[model samples]
Target: MKVRKPRLKAVDFFCGGGGMSYGMLEAGINVLAGIDYEPNCKQTYEHNITGAQFIKADVFELQEQELEDKLNLTKNDDNLILIGCSPCQFWSIINTDKTKSTKSANLLIEFTRFVKHFNPGYVVVENVPGVLRQKKESGLEDFIIWLKENDYKVHFEVHNVAEYGVPQSRKRFTLIANRVTDESIDLIKSVERKVTVRDVLGQVNGFPEIKDGHKDKTDFLHTVASISEVNKKRLKKVAKDGGDRLGFANDTELQLACFEGKDNSFKDTFGRLWWDKPSPTITTKFFSISNGRFVHPDEDRALSLREGATLQSFPKEYKFYGTSTSAIARLIGNAVPPQYAKCIGEAIINNHLNAV
Candidate 1:
C-alpha cells in the first residue's frame, strides 16, 4: 500500500489579494484563511483561492484567543503553519516616505501574538531586506529572540526572487522556524532557471502589440495608459530595443524641465525595458510611463494590468476584481509574487512537515 503524506495547513497574515495564500496552496498546503485590513481584498482573495476564507480586520485589533477560536489552531501542532508576510514597503525603500512606514512597522509584532498563542509547526516570514536592516523598529529582532527562547530553530536569509524563476528583480528576507525537530531548516532553491523579459513578453508570449490607450476587445486587462502628444513624440525618438530617457534629451522641446541641467538623474525613470533582461521591479506605479522603466521594449506605452501581473508571476487565469484600474494595479503591485511564495512554502514543508 502506498502511504499518503499528511496534509500541511497554513494561515497567511497580511494576505492582500491572496498572492501568498495562493502560492501556499499551489505548494500542496491547505491555506485555512487570509487576514488583512483592506476590505477590497476580500473579494479577490476569496474568489481566487479555494478552501480559504478572507478575514477583513486589522491584525492589531485581533486577539490570540479569537484566532484560536476561529481557526482551531493547536499549540505546537506540527501539521500547522503560520505565515507572516506583512506590507512594510514604505520603510523598505530608503527614498520613500518613512512616516507612513512607522505606523505599520509593528505589524510583525501582531503576527507574533498568534505565534505566541499557538507555537505551530513552523513560522514563515517574508519581507523586504530593510526589515532586517531595521530589525530594531520592525520587531524582527525581538521576534527572532522569542522564537529562540521558545526552542525554535530558525533559518533566515535575503533572496532575490528573480533567482527563483520570477521574471522580475525582487529581493525579500525570509525566515523559517521549526520547534518539532532539532535540525535547522534549509531553503532549497526552485528547480526553474532564471527567466528574462524575452522569455515572457512580446507577441509570441500571448502579449501582442498594443498601442497607448489601446484596449484589446477580448481582454480589457491588456490596455495601456494614454500619453500626451509630446510624450508620444518622445516615445518615437527612443531606440527600439532598450532605450533610456536620453533618447530625447537633444529635443529641446521634449526635454523635461526638471532634468534640464542634470545629465544622469533618475536614469531608470521614463526608460524602456530591455527585452533581453528581466524587467525592473513592478511597483504600484507600473501603469505610468513616468514611473520606473515601465515602457514596453518596442511598443510606445507603459505595461498593461495583465502585463504587470504576468511579470510579477501571477498566473493568466488569476482575476483581480476592484473598483478601478488603479485599485486593481495596487492589488497586483502590492502582492507577493506567488512563485516566490511557493518556494518559501515548499522549503518549510521539506523542513518539518510532520505527518499526523
Candidate 2:
C-alpha cells in the first residue's frame, strides 16, 4: 500500500486579499484560517481562497487561546505555521522624511505574543527592506536577542521580487523562522531569472486592450490618473513605446522635484513602459503619471486592474473587491505577489517532507 504525505497547515495574519494563502495553497499546503481587521477583505479572501476560514478581528485584541479555539487548533500539532506581514508604512524609508509613527511597529510585539503562546513550528514574515532598520523602546539589539531567546532558527534576507519571477522591480524583506535546526533551515536558495512585463502580460485568451479606470465585466479596474491639460500635451510629446519626458523637455517644467538640476538622471516618471523589461514597483497610486513608470506602453491611460494584477504575479482569474479605483488598487497594492509566496511555501513543504 502507498502512504499519503501528511499535509502542513498554516494560518495567515493580516491576510489582505489572500495572496500569500494562494501561493501556499498552490504549493499543496492547507491554509486553514486567515485573520485580518478589514471586513471587506473577508469577501475577497473567501472568493479567491476556497475552503479557508476567515476571521475579521484586530489581532492584538484577541488572546492566543481565543485564536487557537477559533481556528480549532490543538497543542499537539507541530505542523502549524504562523505567518504575519504587519503593515510597513510606519517603518518604510519613504516615510522617513516625515514623522515616523510607532503605532504599526507595535504590531510586531503583538505577533510575538502569539508566537510565545502557540509556539508554532514555523513562522514567516514579509515586509519592506526598511523593516530591518526599525527600533523601539527595547531597541534593535534587544529585538534580535529576543527572537534568538525563543530558540528560532531565523533566516532573513532582502530580495528583489523580479529575481523570484515577479515582473516588478520590487524589493522586500523576507524571514523564515523554524524551530527545527538542520541543513533544511536555509532560506536563501538559487535565484530564478528576472520576470519581465512581457512575460506576464503575454497572451491572455479573452480580455485585451485594458483602459484606465475601466472595470471589466468582473467589476475590477486599476486607478486612473487625473492629468492636467498642460501635462497631457507634454505626455503626448514624449512618444510611445517606452518613451519618457526627457524626449520632449526643452526648458520649462524640465526640473522634477527629485531631479531638480541633475543630468544623466533617468527614471520613468510620467513615462511609458517598455513592453520587454520588468515594470517599476506598483505603488498605492500606480495609476498616476508621477507615481512611477505607470503609463501604458500603447494606450493614453495607465494600466488597468487586470494589468496591475498580472504584473503583481496574480493569476488572471483572481477576483478583487470594490468598483472604485482607489479601493481596488488598495486591495491589489497591499497583497503579496502570489508567485513569490508560492516559492517560499514550496521550499518549506519540500524541507518538511524530506525531513519526515
Candidate 3:
C-alpha cells in the first residue's frame, strides 16, 4: 500500500449552508467537515456538496480535545485551516429587533480556544461590519490581539462581495491568518473588480413567472401578497422595461415609504434591470419585490429563490432548505457568496502550496 500525501483539509465552524466551504472547494481545497448548530442544514450540506461531512454540533459545548479526536486531527496537522463565520444577526443592521441576543458575538473567543488547542496553520473569519464596533476590552478585539501575539500574520478587510465576482453588493469583514508567515500579504489587493447582478443572472434560463401564493415546479418560489389592485393598475400604466413607480404614480398615491421620502422609491422597485449594470445586494427577503429593488425590473413578479441565489453568486445547482419564504431567504442572504469565497480560497491555496 502507498502512503498518500496529506490533503488540504478545512473545518467550517458556524457553517450555515456551506457557502464558505463551497467556495473553498471550488479553489481546489478539500473541505472535510462542516460544523453548525443548525440541525436543519445537515441534509442539504451533505447532499449538495457531496463527500463533505456535516456535523450539527454547537461549537460552545465541545472541548477542543473532543474535536481533535472526531476530526482525527492532531496538533501536528499543520495543513489544517479553521474557518469560523459565526452568526452576525446581533450586529447586523437589518436585524433591528432589539430583543435579539448578542450571545453569538462571543464565538470568536471560542474560535481562539480552538486555535490554542490545535494551533492550525491557517484561520479565516467573516462577519458583519458592526462587529468592529465591539469594545477593545471585548472578545472580538482580544481575538485580533491574540492572533498577533501568537505570531500569525493576519490580513483582514471589510470587502464588498461585488469586488470578488459576486453580483450582489454584500460587504463583510474577511480575515485570513497564517501562522507560518513572518510578513503580511495583501489579500484584498489580489482580488479583481466587482461583478454585477447582470453578469451572473443573464444566462440562466427556465425560470417561470411566480405569483404570490402559487408554487413553481421547484417549490422554491416565495409568495408576496398580490400587488394591490391600485398598484397593479399603476404598474400597467408605466412604460415597459424597468420603469419605476414615478412613471405611473399620481400625486395622491405617491406616498413613499418613510425611509425613501423625497428620494425616488421606485428606482429599483417596480423597475426593470438594465442589462449592463450590476445588481443590488440580495437580502433573505429577496423574494418580495417590496422589500428592496428586487422586482425583476422587467417582470411583474420578484426574483425567485433560484434567481436570488444566482445573483448572490451561488452556482445554479445549489439547493437550500425550508418551505417558508423566510427560511430559504435567510440561507441565501447569510451565505458567503461562493464566488467571492473561491477567489480568497484560491489565493490561500496558492500561498500554501508555495510555502509547503
Candidate 4:
C-alpha cells in the first residue's frame, strides 16, 4: 500500500514576476498566491505560475483577511509556508542614493505582521547580504529575535547562487524559520559543481552572434541594447572572453573624461565577461554596458534581455511582461534566481516539513 505524502503549500509575498513562486512549485510545493504592490507583475505572475493567484496590493495596506479569503489559509496551520522575499533595494550595498530607499526600509517588519497572524509552520526569506550587515537598521535583528522567541528554530547564512545551479556569481542571504518541530532545521545545501558562463552561453547554448541592438525575430526579448557610435568603436578594441576597461586605459582618444585622470573606480563598467567564470551579479541595469561587466564575450553589445534572465536562472520559457526594456530588465534583475529558490524549497520538503 502506498501512503500519499501531503504536499507542503506556500504563499509568496513580494513575489516579483513569480520567480520564487515558480521555483517552489517546481520543487513540488503548492504556492497558493503571490502578493505584490506592483501591478506590472500581475500579468507575468498569473501567466507563468498557473496554480497561484497574483494579488496586487501594497503590503502596508494589505489585511490578513484578504490573504485568508484569497489563499484560504487557516491560522496556525503547521504545514503552511510563508515566503517574504521583499525587494531589498533599501538595504542593498550598491552606492545608489539612500534617500530613494528610505521609504521602504521597514518592509521586513511589515512581513512580520502576517507571520505573527498566521504562525505558519515554515517561513523563508531571501535578500541581499547587506540586510544582515545592517540588521539593526534593516529590521532583520528584531525579526530574528521575535521568531526565536516564538519557538522557531531558525537557520540563516549567506551563499553564492552560482554554487546552487545558477550560472552567475550572485551572493544572497537566506533565512529559514520553522516552528513545526524543534528536532532539526538547516540552511539550503549547495551543488557538487558550479555552473559557469561558458557552460550556458555561445552558439552551443543557442546564443549565436547578433549585432549590437539586433533583435531576434522569434523572441523579441532575445535582443541587445543599442550602443552609440563612440561606444561601438570602443567595444571593437576589446578582446573576447574577459576584456576589460584597462584595454583602453592608454587610448587617450576613446577614453572618457571620468577615467582620464587615473580614477578607475567602477572599472567593471563596459567590461566583457569571462567565458570560463560565473558572470558578475546581474542587477537592474544589466542591459547597459555602462553598468557592469554586461558586454557579451563574443559580441560587441551588452547582454540581451533574455540572456540576462537566463543568467538569473529563470526558465528559458519564462515569460516576462513589461512595456519597455528597462521595465523588463528590472523584472529580471530583481529575481531570486529560480534555481536557488528551488534549492530552498527542496531543502524544506526533503526535511519533511514536520507536523505541529
Candidate 1 has which clashing residue pairs, if any?
none
User: What lDDT score goes with residue 70 in model 2?
Assistant: 82
Q: Spell out the clash pairs found in candidate 4.
A: none
Candidate 1 lDDT, 153-182, residue by residue in tens = 988999888888889988889898988778
What tens-digit string does per-residue lDDT give for candidate 4 at 132-245?
999998899999999999999899999999888999999999999988777555645576778888888787988777888776645437877899999998888878889888
Q: Model-by-model lDDT, in order?
A: 0.85, 0.74, 0.71, 0.87
Model 3 weakest lDDT span, ten residues long: 216-225
Q: Which of candidates 3 and 4 is the stronger one according to lDDT?
A: 4
Best by lDDT: 4
Candidate 2 to truth, TM: 0.87
Per-residue lDDT tens digits of candidate 3, residues 1-356? Answer: 55544667888888888889899898888898898888877766786766778987888897888888887887846688899888887777663664654677678778779987888888888888767766352366778788889888888878877777777667788888887556454455433665655455533554555554455445344334356666566556555445666665454564345524444533555555544556777777777656666666555666777778788777767777775666777788778888878877877776665563
Error of 3 at 267 (Å): 7.4
Comparison by lDDT, 1 against 4, better one: 4
> What are the per-residue Cα lDDT tens digits for candidate 2 across 5-96?
56889999889889899988988889998889878788889988978988888976988999888888876355888898876777676635
Query: How much is 51 displaced in model 2, in angstroms?
Result: 1.0
RMSD of each: 1.9, 3.1, 3.5, 1.6
lDDT of 2: 0.74
25: Cα error in model 3, Å? 0.9
